[model samples]
Structure formats: C-alpha cells, structure tokens
Target: MKFFNRLLIDFAYYLQNSVAYQQKRRFFYNLLENDEYKYKKYFDICMIILIFSSVSILIYEVKKDVHDYLNIFNSYVISFIFLIEYLLRLWVASSVSKVIINQDEYSDLLGREFDLWFVTKKILKEKFEYILSPKAIIDLLAIMPFFHELRLLRIFILFRVFKLFRYAKSFQTFSSVLATKKFEFVTLGMFASIVIFVSSVLIYVMEANDPNSPIKTLYEAFYWSIVTISTVGYGDVVAVSKEGQFVAVVVILAGIAVLAFTTSLFVSAFTEKLDDIKESKTIQDISKNKRVYLICGYENIAKEVAKKLLLAKFHVVVIDDSLQRVEDAKKDGLTALNYNPGSIESYAKLNIDMSVQVKAILCLREDDVANVYTALTVRSINTDVFIMSLLMNSKNRNKLIYSGVNEILYDKEFVGLVAREYVGQPVAFEAIHTLRSETSAIHMEEIAITERILAKYPTVEKLENIKYRIVLLGVHKKSSSKFFFNPSDDTELETGDFLLVIGNYMFIREFNKHLSHKGEV
Candidate 1:
C-alpha cells in the first residue's frame, strides 16, 4: 500500500510537469496553494529519511565487504537519480514563475519562440555555471557515469545530505550567527589555519623517521594535527621514539592551549553577534509604522523612557556610544543607531525632520555636556520642535532651558517630586509626567469655536450636561492664557472660545462630534 502511494505521488509530480499546467500557474502559486504546512511536512519527512539512510551507509562502511557492495550500488543509483532529478528540476524551473513572475524566465528561457528541446537546452546551459559550484560539483560527482571506480566518491553524495542540514533550524540559526560575526569568525579561522599548519609540519618532522610511526607525509601529519588539537586523540596514529615522545608532549600541550583559546574566541564572537541580532530585532519591531523617539544614551532612565515611548506607539531610535547598549536596544526591537548623539552631523545624518509631525527628541546622553550640546543643535534646527532633555546635574537645567530646550527633565527634581508625592500629593507623579509628556500620543488639543457655527448655536457648554462621558474641563476665553476651570453649563460659547476636555483617547475622539456637528450647522 505504501509502495502504491509512493508510485501515485511520483506519477502526480510527473503529470504536474506538463507545459499546459505551467501556463495557468499564477505568481505566488505556492502561496495560493494554501498548503505551506503540507509542503514543509513532506520536506521534513524527506530530510529525516535522507539523514537516516546516509547514517546507515556510513555505519555499513566500517565492514569492508558490505561497504564495497553498498558503495557500488549507491554510486550508480544516486548518480542516475541525480541525473533524472537534475533534468526534472530544469523541466519544472518554468513553474517558479507561477510562484513569482521573473521577466527573464518569460522572455529569455520559455518564450514563445523556444520549443521544448530549446527550453531544456537553454536552462541546462544557463544553470551550468551554478551547477559547477563546489557543492553542486560534489553533488554531480556523486552521480557520475563511472560508478564502480568512484565507490569512495559515494561519500561525496553525503555532501548533498549535508546541504539538507542548512534547512534545519539549528543550522539555519548557526549560519545567521556566523554571518553576524563573519569578521570575527574569519579572524579565528585564520588563527586556526596557522595553528593547524604549524602543528602539522612539526608532527611530520617529529614522527616521519620513526619505524612504528603512521605519520609519513604532510597529509598524514595534518590528520594527526587535527586529532590532537581537537583533543579527539583517535589513537590510530601516534609517535614512538624518545625525541618523538618529547615532541608529542609539547604538541599536546600546545593543542590543549590552542583548543581552549579557539573555543573562547568563538564563544566571545557568538555572544557579541547574538546581542547584535537581538538589538536589531527589537529595533525592527519599534520602527514599524511608529513615530521616532530618539534616546540619546543607554542610561537606566533611557530604558524607562523607551518603555513609555513604546506604549505611546513610537519607534525609539537610540544613539549611544556603547556597542553593548546598542545590542541591548536591538534586542528590545529599538533602533540603536550606534553613534555619539552629541555631534550635529549625527543628527543630520539620522534625518531629523523638524517639519514632520514627530513626537519629540528625548536627550539623555551619559555626559551632561553632550546632552546640552545635542539639545542646542536640535533647537537651532527648528525652534518650534519640542526637545525633552534630562539634565544629569541640576546646574545644566537652567542652561538647557535657556539653550531653547522646550522641556528640561531634572532627575533631582523628579526624585524630589516623587518623595513629595509619597508624603501627600494632589496627583500621581506618573500621571503628571504623562500629561506633561509633549511626545505622548494622547494629547489635549484645544479647538476654538468659530463664528459661522456660533451663529446657529448659542452656547457650546450647553452640551456638557447631557450625561455623556465627555467632560468639559475648562473654557479659555479668546486670546487669554487664563482658562475657566469647570465652566458652567449655560456659559455662552462665543467665537474663539477654547474648550478643554479631559478623557482618554476614545472620549477625545468622540468629543470631535461637537465640532463636526457645528460645521454642518
């Protein structure tokens, strides 16, 4: 029954390879199929089967006679399968357009001008270069015509299975980790190469002349060198003479030291890279359709500020000199633009748009001087733009305010305020901060009563007593900073009348109904 099922599947795949089926395939055909999970399931199953089969073959190779027979069978069978698979892949390459339209595929490969034979020839010729890459070459070599002579080359077939490891979760993540730490890895690789080469040469010199020695050529020395350094000590090869023994001690000690050092290098590299990846992930999340909130430094307060900005739907763009903090920001899905925020060029390069409806710049650089400088540069660009700067020292607060920062957040004042509130305060410290935060998404906007609408409506405050949730907090008479707190219901609302309402965002939105109705009136 399983055999029948496998045969049916193969037949379906063959039938699906037809040109008629190809033309009707849409771009994103794979996506449209709605069987992504099914495809992945089948792919996973194939991977498991392939891995087990390879492992079984490797185990069988330990027995000489069975190894020879199995190797011969695999050499021919795999090569033939690869040949057919290669041909089939070329045939169905056109179907990728059903996945997504590539113009080159339409005009160049499978154009109306090309016949079946021509298309096949063209694809093979075009992909011939890619087919010659190290991996592909090994794959093709595993399946070549001289099957029996290349029994050992069946081992190269294992490379194709190794390719499957790339698709695995662990290997994929490892690859990304390597990519992130490519430079460090490259340096470590160079160090390892030097150690390996030096060890191999020394081992060959020390062991080559010994009668009982297995290390004959430089190649044999390389194998021994790898075993020693990795502490694998396979025991298949060893040195025997007194001088060789002395050399062995030195080599083994060197190997141990080198092994520890290399391990440390990789550990450090991966640690740094992982942190970077985390920070980048955090920045990406923060930047998604959100307003920018530039954090000047990686202070503890900056962390709290970032949380607040995130709550208000703002993408926090941080500029900090500390690479570690930048990585931390990335981990939090915040844009840690790694630079000293003190420089004018840094702000300019970051594209500080004064005119755009941005929330505000929160300056909290580690250095008081840097924060003040950053604030000054920002204020110079756009005097109308809001700047919320934290002054580390109370002395800088007056300077920052005079320098044209809209709001100066004094840590001392904040701490004192919190203490005062703990004793007994009118409002919560957090609530006061929320209302004072110019960058908050929830803002109290004052809309003036225009005359055209007032001609029809005698009073705007009359609607306040309707028992709805929207409260009339205050009324500001025209051109006066003085606002009437909790204005009367019958107060005649004239032109240029400013009404202050207090509620959460939904009520504020609902509060706009009065303006819209007035416009219609």
Candidate 2:
C-alpha cells in the first residue's frame, strides 16, 4: 500500500511537470486572459472532437439497449470523475487567491517560508462549497441525472456533453464575444420581433381561408408564421382562394425584405464588434509579459509619444476620452484602452498593477489639473515607479514637484527652447539625428580610465589603440559641469575623465576593457 501510494505521487508529479500538460494549461489560461487566436484554435479542435465522439456514441446506442447496467455504471463513473475534477479546479483557483492573502499570515505564524505539506493540506481541506456554486451546479447537472427513460436520453447526453466544450478556448471566446456583443444581439432581436409580427398577420390572412390549411386557429398561426417569415413555402398548406393568394404575395415580399435587412444588420454589427475585439486583443497581447507604459491623454502630443515609443520597441498603451483620439491611436498601431487614466477602476481594467516590471508612465494630459490627477493615481498604485509628465502650465510646477513626479516637461518652455536653438544653430539641429538613429556608428561613450590603463600605458602615446577607430569628441570632467571639447595628447588622462568618445560597438568594447583593471568584471 505504501509503495502504491508513493507510485501515485510520483505519477501525479510527473503529469504536472510534463510539457503537454503545461501547454494545455497555457492554452486554457490564455483563453481566460483573452488571447483570441490561441484560445480559439485550441477550443475549436476540442469542440470538433467532442461533438464527433458524443454523436458517434449516440448513433451506436440507437442500435442497442443503451440502458444496460454496465453502461449505466460507466456513466456514473464518468460523472463522479468529472465532479472530482471540477472540485479540484475550484480548489486550485481558491489556492491562487490564498497564496496572496496567506503568505504574510503564514510568514508571521511559522517565522519561515511556506512548506509543501501546508500547501497540500490547504488543497486537501478545500470545502466542497467552492465547487457547488451556480456554475458548478450546472456542471453537476450536465454530468449527472440521466435525462430520459429507456431510450438512452442521447439528446440529453449531447446537451450535457457540451459542458466539456466550455473547457476549450473557442467556446470561451464565443461566450465572451456573445457577452460583449449583447447589444448587437438586442438589435437583432428587435428585427426578429418585427418579422414575427408581420409574418403572423400575413399567415392569418392567407391560411384562414384555406379549407385544408394546418394553420386554421390563431394558435396554429405560428406554424405558417415560421414558414412565411423564413420563405419556406410548404405546398401541403396551400392557400387556393384569390384573397389568400394575395396575402401569399405580401408574405413572400416581406420575407425577402426581412432577409436583406437581417443580412445587412449582421454585417454592420459584426464589423463594429470585430474592430472592438481586435483593439482590445492588441492591447492585451502587447501588455502580456512586459513592462507597462501609460499615456494619460489623447492629444497630438500623445499620438507623437505613441509613435516614438512604438519605434523604441516599448509596449505603449493609451487611455483617453476623445473618441476620435482613441480611434486614431488604433489607426496608428497603438493599443488604446477606452477609459480615464485618473480613475482607480481604469487602472485595474488596464492591469497596471499586475505588470511587475513597469519602466515608467508618461502623463501628458492637456489640462494641468488632469495631468496632476493622472500622476497621483499612478503613484498611488506604485510608490517606487518612475513618472515623467508634461506640465502645460509653469504655474503648476511647484504642485507637480510635490506630487512625486521625477521630471516634468513644460511644453511651452521645452518647445520654445528647441525652436530657439533650431533658428540659432543648424549644426545642433543636425546632431539630433545622430542621437536618435540606431544604426549610427558615431556613438558617444563615457569611458572611465582606471588604474589598469594607468599601469599599462604610462603616457598618452601608448593610447593609440583607443584613438584609432573612434574620434575623441571631448572629456567630461566628473567633478565639474564642464566640457573639454578638444583635449590635446599632452593632456594626461586622469582616473575620472569620462571621455565623450564617438565610436562603433567594437571600439567601445575594447576601450572599456583597457580602462577597467576589472577587465569586463
């Protein structure tokens, strides 16, 4: 018994750690996380297999006594297994929440880290209540309670079997889309209502006159009602009289009109809904595994910021109210979540707190008050986060400084200075390209000459290797805020002269090693 238990533990551990299990886990979690493509594909394949298997079994059962004791026993076993799995799933989900809540509590109680036994106990002790909720109830119904008597209740089995399809990604996506597109479905419902009204009236006027008509009574009007609206004119229920024939013409024309209207409505609604899903998916995808970059407002500057950030390979997401600006951001390859950045719920929707490694947030709202609010909201979530903001008014600088913004760029002051420089110096304007260009060979480096170089080369003449591939632009003296533009060879290199050397990656690597006795250490 001991060996058997040990073998089961090893098998479970192996199953948990296996590549296929991990992939399956990722596929389902991605579905929950709103990854459209991966989730959809995974679910679609599973759905096809499920539908095929269930339907195949149902067909086979049609030829035999499906209510046999062995078959009933097998179904009971399957249901029990499914119930246990569902309970385990709920337990795991609750444990994830507890890991956050109990970590601090356990650390204080144990005065040490969490152990495997405690975790196992927590898992084992998870009450049946969690899995017995509404969804779980539905799952229980789906797996248990045979729907009908001796005929095997194949259709009931079919319905119950569909519950397994929920575990697939495609089904989840379809559910999400149905939820988000509920309004579209509502509009479709209105059209359906109109079609029903018109069809019932036409069917009553036409079929009431026919002697052999199945749609004789008001309640029976529904039979012809469906046939007329769907344009499926069954010859068995013929309207032979002149007045009845007139009603038939109207019904057929109304059916054509309804068809056209429904087709158009579906196309338009689907297009709008598809755009929303795609934009939402894009933001979710980019923000999946990396740091967060927040854009406070939707303006021209915000758009420009997005362009620059996208170029720099940053996962930039925007929040703004202007419908046009949000639409423009979508047009310009930036994921824009529709929300006010100043709100707490807005941050939660964006999952800003969940991003463990956010580099910075740029608050560039047009209004000073709004920008300040945005900054405050960001700081509230993460105190240690780096924030840079655009101060539209210089008057708000003092207040912003007090709000924990590391740097604030006043648009008027910053842009005015740039304009002045552009008018005064053409060379300074040209140098901006070198600073921004990724492929430029003429790159600046801050080389710190240490004891290693001093010991190796006694004089500046021996520094020929450093001067060969690179231009010695200047030396930035560490102690002073001064630039020595052209230091001659006779100027002896000190321990702290951060040389503004312009060179390629190769020369920079070589120079870095020559100076640090640490030699790349």
Candidate 3:
C-alpha cells in the first residue's frame, strides 16, 4: 500500500511539472470551456447539428417505426458522441492531481505528514460539485439512452434538446440576464404558487360534484389553474358553477398582473445588460484581427497617436474609462472600449493571453499613477508585448520603468528641448520639422538586413551603387544596440542590422524593390 501511494505521488509530481501535459490540458480546457476559442464556433455548430438530429430522430420514432439502420445510427453514433463529451467535461472540470500535489507541497512546507484522507475528501468534493451542476446533470441524462438494455431510461433521450443551451450563445446570454433577477423571480414565483394553489383547491371544491363541470379531479383543477394564470384559457376546461366561474375571473385577473410584472422584469434586466453584451461582441470582433496597437487613453497625445497609426494603416484599439471619450474615439473612426486600464479583469476580458495579435500597448493616460498602474497590470498579464508610456512627472520615471515600460515619452521635456533648438537654429529646426511632417516628400525608413541582402551587398560601399536617389544615414547593429553614423565605404554589414536611409517616398520604394529583385535574376 505504501509503494502504491508513493507511485501515485510520483506520477502526480511528474504531471505537475510536465510541459506537454500542461499544454494538452490547457488545449482541452480552451476547447471545452472557452467561448472565445478560435475554433469554438465550428465545434458549437457541430454539436448543435448532432443535438437537433438526435432529437428529430426521437420525435420521428413517436409516429412511425424508424428503419433499423436509422435506429442504430441514432442509438450508437449520437450516444457515443454525447458520452465522450460528458467524460471530457468531467475531466476538465477539476484536476485531482493538482489538488493532491498542492496538498503534499503544503504539508512539506509545514513539516507535517500528508493527510491522505483530507486530500481525498477535497478532491471528491470538487468533483461532486461539478457532477451535481445543472449542465452536468443534463449531459448525463442526454447519454443515458445509450444503455438500450435499460428501456426505462430511454425516454430521457428527449433531454438532448436541452443540450442546445450549451452550444447557443444567445441562450446563454438570456439565461445570464434572467439569472441576475433571481430575487425578483423567486418572489414572483412564490406569489404565483400561492395563487395557483388557492385557485386549484377552491375550483376543485366548487365543481368536484357538479355533473357539468370539467374539474372532476384535483389534478385537473391544478392544470386548469396553471393554464389560466398563464393567460392561456383553453375553453375545453370550463367552470360551469357560479362559485367556480367567480374563481376563474379572479385567477385570470391575477394572471394578467403576473405576466405584466414578468414582462417588465425581463425588459429591465435586458436593458441593463445591453452595454455589456455590446462590449462582449466588440471584444470578439477585435480578436479576429491579425494585429492591433492598443492605446490605453483617449486624451490629446493618445488621440494624435491613434490618428497617425490609423493613417499609416495600422489597426488601433483605444481603451478609456470615460464613456464620452470612448464615444469620441469611435466617432474618429478608431475602435474604442470603455474599460479601466488598471484592472486585471479588463485584460482578461480583452483576451490578451489568447491573442498574439497585440503588437504593442501604449499607456498614454494623463495621470502618472494611472499610467504606472496600467503598465504594471499589463506587464503582469503579458511580458512580451512592448509597452510605451508617457512620463507626466520626473518622479514617476523610475516607477514606470520598474513597471516594465519599454519606452517613456516625456512630452514636456521634448517640447522644451525643441523650443530651445528652434530659438538657436531656426533654419535647421524648420528643415527637420518639414522632413518629419506629412508635407515633405522626403521620408526616413529603416531596412532590415536579411541573409539575401548580405549575400548581394556585403559592404556599405555596395549600397552606393544602387540606382536610387537615397542617402545612407546610418546602420543600426542589433547585436551591440548601437547605430554607426556615416561609416567608411568598406564598413562590412552583417545580418540582423538595420540600414537607416532618407529619400523621397518613391525613391525609397524603388530602392527596396531593386534590392529585393537584385538576387532573383
């Protein structure tokens, strides 16, 4: 028994540390639980088709005998699919090995013996809670028809129709909206139950002995009460006696009031969820893009950057806490979201981890503290995505840097330096400004040195022979993170270096084209 226990513990530890196991588990979890998964729509459509087909088969069998082939297909194929789905859901719902490893680690930290019974109870409790959930129960019932030997459980096959709730997003949203009004619904349900019970008993007592009445049994009266309260008075079940007629009139009035209340309740709940639903849809739409630049503010600097990026054909998404700012951004033709940049939940909602499309995050919020917090929150969730923030105060420079900001733009200092330079060298400043602005035809662009480029032009001297009106400004060496300006003619170029050149837009385009096609022939 001790050896068996040790073997179990060793396997649990291995699983906890295994990268392959973790990746496979995460893949299954995303496929099963994540609505934002890329292939989830295809999976959902397949499940919906299977569910509808199985339910249709069940309905058809009611009127006529299904062919033997059809019956076998429905009983075996559909049931097997549902059974596998149930087991996958159960497997991903909780990790027993995770619990065991965590408990063992905690026991070691405390210098105490591992409590096997305690860990066993915790694992069982987690699994039991999942098994008893509403969706899990439906899944279980939907697969019961596979046991054809147990004919009594075959009728539960109808539960397959309920499986649509798992695959349809609209159904999930509606259910969520209703769930938020649980208190109102519960109170309304209690009041309706009381009215229904009283009416059922009164009508049964008033017409139980009348030869002309339809409510001869208590069950019939109960059914009639339910139908009347729902405002569906099927004239087939009528109350002939005077007392029973009076009870019917009162119940119908109560039914109208109950329905009105229910309608208003649903309308209010849905009204409150409209914005949230729109935001969710927006997130889904944004996730489809191949790449996007995230702007964490909608202020002046952020607005200017967004405009430039948009003009440059880069996808830009702006996020702000102000609804007015978000609206303003949308009006300016930029995608915007009203979300708190400092909150971790906002990043999760944006699906930052699942999307590799976010090229860079810019924290341009005006407040230094908010910028630092946003940077920290972003860094906590994503370490690889480049982040740039505006440093509003010199004191917060270190704070932003420590928060994992890649670049800091001190607007005031830059503007001050430019003003001083303009005062001393007006002509030079004007020329530089014109070249950087859109009004000038001259452009500065960086060309990355690939293996092909190195093979064709091994030295900076070779670039001089190109048939283009461009100037070699400098070369950026990636290995040393240094830029060599005006290097000698024989300066050797290496792979992964960037050539900084300035020329007319068309000249630069032709220069790149020439280099690309040079080695082709």
Candidates in order have lDDT scores of 0.64, 0.66, 0.88
lDDT of 2 by residue, 253-284 (tens): 87777777667765665576786667566656
Residue 197: error of model 1 in Å?
33
**Best by the TM-score measure:** 3
Please give each candidate's TM-score.
0.39, 0.53, 0.72
Which has the higher TM-score value, candidate number 2 or candidate number 3? 3
Candidate 3 per-residue lDDT over residues 1-521, each given as its tens digit? 55776777789989888999989888888887898787878888998998888888888988999998877777888899999888888888999889989988898899987788888999999999999999999999998888866887778778888888999998998899899999999999999999999999999999999999988999999999999999998888889999999999999999999999999999999999988888887887788777899999899999999999999999898889999999999999988999888888887788654238888899998889989999999999878889999999988899999999999999989999999999999999999889889868998889998888888888988885345889888899888999999878898889999999899989998888766665642
Clashing pairs in 2: none
Candidate 2 regions exceeding 4 Å error are 1-81, 85-151, 164-228, 233-289, 354-357, 392-395, 410-435, 438-521
Give stretches of model 1 more than 4 Å off. 1-291, 380-383, 421-458, 476-478, 490-498, 503-521
What does candidate 1's lDDT look like per residue over 1-521, in tens digits?
Answer: 44653454455455457666654343223322222233644554564565456547766766745656565545555456556545543443344322222332454475543233444455556566556645456445545533546456545655656555433545656666766666766876787788788878887888898778888989998988788777888999887767667767777887787778767766876797776665555443443423566778877888878977777676677888788987888677676767776676766655445546356878876567878888887777777767888888876678888777888888788788779886685567667668657665455667567765466556755554234466576889876667888876576777888877655556666656655464544
The model with the greater lDDT, 1 or 2, is 2
